[model samples]
Target chain A: MKAVTYQGKKKVEVKEVGDAKLIKRDDMLVRVTSTAICGSDLHIYHGLIPGMYDDYVIGHEPMGIVEETGPDVTRVKKGDRVIIPFNVACGECFFCTNQMESQCDNANDAKDTGGYFGYSETYGGYMGGQAELLRVPFGNFVPFKVPEDAEVEDEKILFLSDILPTAYWGVDNAGVKPGDTVIILGCGPVGLLTQ
Target chain B: MDYRLEHAKRTNHVETYNFEKTHDIDQTLLEATKGGADVVIDCVGLDAKRTAMEKVETALMLQGGSLGAFNTAANVVRKFGTIQVIGVYGLKYNMFPFGHLFERNVQVKMGQAPVIHYMPELFRQIQTGKIDPTDIITHRLHISDAPRAYEIFDNKDESCIKVVLKP
Candidate 1:
């Protein structure tokens, strides 16, 4: 299978990589139909974010058809179209139950942060979604089922993997109220989305 | 340039600023908002305001870049106003405006945005016409052009606000 891999700082290339398959009982294999380059990925690209290893596949946003699912994965089936969240969260964890999947204790035990695919060793080193296929851990908890009848474009919904929700989280975190003036400094995707 | 400053003006009624043009952002915003802005959010982080040499030093890992935007926020936030820092900052800073922020009784909230937590509501909003996240995508390239795409976005080239790579 073909996937994008990190060559070095300021370098990324399309390369042949092994195919993805179900690794854990809660895992699901996704045939990626759509993916986006996230701002967080750029951080990894620049080598600014630590713990990144060479040849690590890099991406976070992905939505596609579920090719296979582990027996423990109850929320999504093999043929279902789903959007995979960047964080690989076990629904049973303390943080996951508390609506904090990004900080789920079960995914990345080395740090307080949860498992984010393709970030590096610090982020649990899961292979990313910018590939022919992806291995999604704890699939039942993270894969959001897209409606069969809905007709939204992949470009429109691909952001659900990270940025859109992140922007919404920013506004929500700031406790933005009606008639309140909120100032955003950076005009990057996340900042623009927040605006 | 797929700029959306007009949207801010129309919906949020926000006024834009070019910090380079205005020598004193705090003074300008202070006067414009009548004393100060009620809420000041710092999305610009470590590299917010740095001299050319200062940037070089930070790049060489000499001095830590921190609180450039926070200082501006501390100055422009009204008495008892709130300042939300969305920008990532350093663990240590040579100088911090603790006195000003403390005296103003300003409320501050800062942290990583819990992306998954907000996904459901935002997804619903996008399903409706309430929000459009795709509008920010200024460039789209093939997966083979991923390297160039990363360069353009990192450099902010050609007014590139965002890039969505088609893989």
Candidate 2:
């Protein structure tokens, strides 16, 4: 399979990598149809993210079709088009129970600091979706079904994997009122989304 | 309104503070607001050139009125006006004119934006045509050209607001 790998600072390459498959009962294999490069990925590209290793698959935002799923995965099935959340979390953890699945205790325990796919060392070192296929863990918790009549494009839906949620979070965090004037610092994707 | 100059231009009420050719930030702001602005939001986040912590210290050293975002916010705002700081600064810092805040009764708000909580609402806004996130995407390139996209975005190339790479 081919995947975009981060080599070092300001470096990335599309290279051949081993195939991915279902690794857990709750895991699902997705044949990636669309993927996006996120600003967070630039942190790795610029080597600002410490502990970044070589051959790291680089991407998190993706919308794809389920190629296969483990027996325990029930939220989506083969042939279902879906959007993959950036994070891979166990639904049974305290954070997951509270709807803060991004900080799931069980998933965090598995990695140094758990995060979604394609993040650097600070987050969990899960491979990302800028590849031919992706192995999505806890598929039931992360894969969202695409609306039947939705006219949203893959690029737009792909943003739901991280930036869209992040931008929305920023506006909410700022407590922006209906008529309040909000000024975002960075005009990057996340910042622009706030506008 | 550094990177937001273009977007702010779309809004009739938005006044920009360009530091590139102007040294009189206070005066520039005053002219923009026509005496003073009701609210001042700092998006520069401790950027040395824009934040100018040293300049603020110099003003304090000379016993000058408040300067920089904090002091400017205090001075240029109407009494009891609001100052929302979206910029990042040193946690263990000092040298701010804390007394003026009380004198003017200014309100200061600052913090990191928690982006997850607002996803549902933002999504609805996009769906409803209230805002177009795509407008910010000034550059679109192939996934193979991702390196160039970063170069343009980082360097702030002309009219390059956001770069989207198709993979």
**How is the predicted docking of candidate 2 categorized under the CAPRI scheme?**
incorrect
Candidate 2 pairs with clashing backbones: A86-A116, A87-A116, A169-B114, A169-B115, A169-B116, A170-B115, B45-B87, B45-B88
Relative to the unseen true structure, what is the C-alpha lDDT of residue A167 in candidate 2, on a scale of 0 to 100? 57
Q: Report how far residue B69 has shifted in candidate 1, in Å.
A: 2.6
- Cα error, residue B94 of model 1, in Å, equals 3.7
RMSD of each: 2.5, 6.3
DockQ (CA atoms), all models: 0.54, 0.23
Given candidate 2, what's the lDDT at residue B93? 39
User: So what's the TM-score on candidate 1?
Assistant: 0.90
Residue B140 CA displacement from its true place in model 1, Å: 2.1
| Index of the highest-DockQ prediction | 1
Candidate 1 regions off by >4 Å?
B1-13, B47-49, B52-57, B60-66, B90-92
Interface Cα RMSD for all candidates?
2.3, 4.3
Q: Candidate 2 vs. truth: CA RMSD?
A: 6.3
